[model samples]
Target: MKSITLFLCLFTYFSASAQESCMTVENIKALDAQWEEKNLNPDPEFFKRVLADDFVWVHNHASMIDTKTSTVKRAEKQAANEGSDTRSRIQSEVKVAITGNTAIVTGFTIVDRGPTPTRYHFMRTYVEVNGTCFLTGNHTMAIPEGE
Candidate 1:
């Protein structure tokens, strides 16, 4: 009886952990929405919760690289200078793809800060770690003005 009870307990624990590790499209979409919201309105807690400690972001075709610490600092700075610029952005054509414990999200965004809007293409990579998802990597490319 003791042996059977221990086996059942182990099985139940593993099952729960497996379920928690599974990533769905809806989950990715929700996370993506949170990322977008943070971008528009900087949230330090959101960044801390979602980004991995070693997270790295490459921007504008590698013109800039940011680590998790740098990102948080930049967001803090942006939050401080909030009223100086009227910048807002909208994301579109977003798609999520999952493979094993990793997910890749790609999208296009248009930022309106002035009379002319600038467009960008972005990709974010998320990895499941101990039943939680964290943004591990990010890349962004600017779309040329015309085509």
Candidate 2:
């Protein structure tokens, strides 16, 4: 009786864990863009939902490390300033990999703020819990002003 119960418990645990699935690369990419664009309109609740509690972002030029709270505050402020007005981010060299419940993505973004576009290289990490994915870390570096 004890052996049968232990076997059943282990099977139940593994079955439950296996049932949990992560988001696809395409889905994750869309989600990333959505969260970033939210900065323009600044949805505090959405930000809270998309970002992990310990989220961290390393800025490009300023090299400032931003926590989740600070990033959300900046987004709110940006919305107060009438938003950035940049909606299109053309991504190049994009790649996304998933391992278990975590995903790592690397890409370059061409930000079209005006006639002259700026390029940035970025790597972002996400993790899924209970079928929901959240951004955990983001590191970006400005591509030098040249080809």
Candidate 3:
């Protein structure tokens, strides 16, 4: 029937459009890099854009999880530090997974943790809000010293 044919066409069109709207690897990387750059430069406003109200972060070296408020306050305080070593990181093996409006970014990063450099594998999850990605979870594992 014409009704059945029209239904099929509509379904196909919608399905294809939905698939096209899903996040791509380059899009994920660009959005994530924006947040990273803001953080590296120590901007408190970065938290406003990239974090949800319920954001939480698990520090690799900390015994406690950080809440959005706590993390923002800490970054604000750190922004005032003068003459301190500027931190840098080298990232690799990055991967992104998207599910509906949620995305998970996983990667390995080499950071100067102390007097020596260290590698860590990290996972961060985000949800798209108003077409902008907002981080909701974070975890990182340090790679072994020799490996």
On TM-score, the leading prediction is 1
- After the best TM-score superposition of candidate 2, give how far the Cα of residue 90 lies from its true spot, in angstroms: 2.7
Residue 91 miss distance in model 3 (angstroms): 1.3
Candidate 2 C-alpha lDDT tens digits along 1-147: 999999999999999987866578987888877765675467777887889999999988656999899988877777778776676677778789998889998988877777777798989999998889999999988787875
Q: Cα deviation of 139 in candidate 1 (Å)? A: 0.6
The Cα RMSD in angstroms, rounded to one decimal, for candidate 2 relative to the true structure is 4.8
Mark the regions of model 2 whose C-alpha exceeds 4 Å error after superposition: 1-20, 85-88
Tens digits of per-residue lDDT for model 3, 1-147: 999999999999988866563266678777666655655566777877678899888877666798889878867877787312547667788889998888899998777747888787888888876556678998878888987
Worst ten in a row by lDDT for model 2: 35-44
**Candidate 2, position 66, lDDT:** 91
When 2 and 3 are scored with TM-score, the better candidate is: 2
Residue lDDT tens for model 1, 1-147:
999999999999999877775377889878987887788888777888899999999999789999999988878887887822537878999999999989999999887778988898999999998788999999989899988
Q: Rate the local accuracy (lDDT) of all candidates.
A: 0.87, 0.83, 0.76
Candidate 1 vs 2: which has more lDDT: 1
What TM-scores do the predictions have?
0.83, 0.76, 0.75
- Candidate order by TM-score, decreasing, is 1, 2, 3
